[model samples]
Target: MKITREVVQGLYKQTGTARVDTDVAASFQVGDTIQARNINPTGHTRLPRYIRGKKGSIATDNGVFKFADSLAHGAGTQPQHLYSVRFTAQEIWGGEAPAQDSLYIDLWDDYLEPA
Candidate 1:
């Protein structure tokens, strides 16, 4: 992939989604239950430590996008679906936490799996 003048110009000229489109299959979907993968990478990542190993449900499919963790390390885009996941306060903070509350965060597919 060359970064020629036309490539830069074409990207800036886009009118629709700025998200990268790829054929990668969605690992989860809206309403699908998932658990954040427990990981502690020594490299750049957006996955928060608090969310790791916690259970949640997919609230929205935000579509495919480049993996920032990989990008930061000079790895390929590794495009995959990103989603808005909803976690109950109880689920995340345990039974002592308020049951009426919830926390929503966007996460990439690589950070989650079926719960």
Candidate 2:
């Protein structure tokens, strides 16, 4: 996905106008199911290399989705979108993760929960 100048410009405006704070965390709760797409279904993605083939429930309820940034996609674009998903570390990485810890990745609408 490529982020157009218009989208970047809008982000700039939002940041400049204080509509959105840079310190904000898109995922702030549990059970928040989000929609995401495999950045590189063939290769690797920052979406936690562990969460490639497994599935989990939304443990948080974060607010509106936002961009995941193409920095992980190897495009370095600012493709912005809406995403709200929360998964257990075990769900993504399996038994190797701590039982008390989980990973909440802000994804795009393209990645999602069970319908």
Candidate 3:
């Protein structure tokens, strides 16, 4: 895979470590478990508008934790953590979503709220 400089920088921001490389790749499949927490105290991003306040089970693990680069405000990073948390659609979206519909998102350890 073609690694980029931004990806390398992203790892440093989340982990605060510079030992990582851009070529190091990691990914997750379905049915994997993970954790998602709220790091944003004042502002907001695209981390699921509803899941900001509640903690749910990992419905599907997708890929590695690509932390955002400090320069990019933690927007990108390399694949380090191998797991994704999945929350039930009903748990996050409420009764509006179908019973079978669940929300699966790939979040880094910093985003988890601690089960």
Candidate achieving the largest lDDT = 1
What residue pairs clash in candidate 3, if any at all?
Answer: 36-112, 37-111, 37-112, 37-113, 58-86, 59-86, 68-74, 68-75, 68-76
In model 2, state the lDDT of residue 103.
65
Q: With candidate 2 superimposed using the best TM-score fit, by how many Å does residue 26's alpha carbon deviate from the native?
A: 16
Which pairs, if any, clash in model 1?
A: none
What RMSD does model 1 have? 5.2
Q: Estimate each model's TM-score.
A: 0.81, 0.41, 0.49
- For residues 33-103, what per-residue lDDT tens digits would candidate 3 score against the true structure? 43455556544343555666666655444444455433245544534543446677887767888989766
What tens digits encode model 2's per-residue C-alpha lDDT throughout 7-112?
8888766453212233444332344344343444545344655554445555544443333434455764333333345567776667988988866554543454
**By TM-score, who's the top model here?**
1
Superior by lDDT: candidate 1 or candidate 2: 1
Per-candidate clashes, comma-separated: 0, 16, 9
What would the TM-score be for candidate 3 when compared with the true structure?
0.49
Alpha-carbon deviation at 101 in model 1, angstroms: 0.7
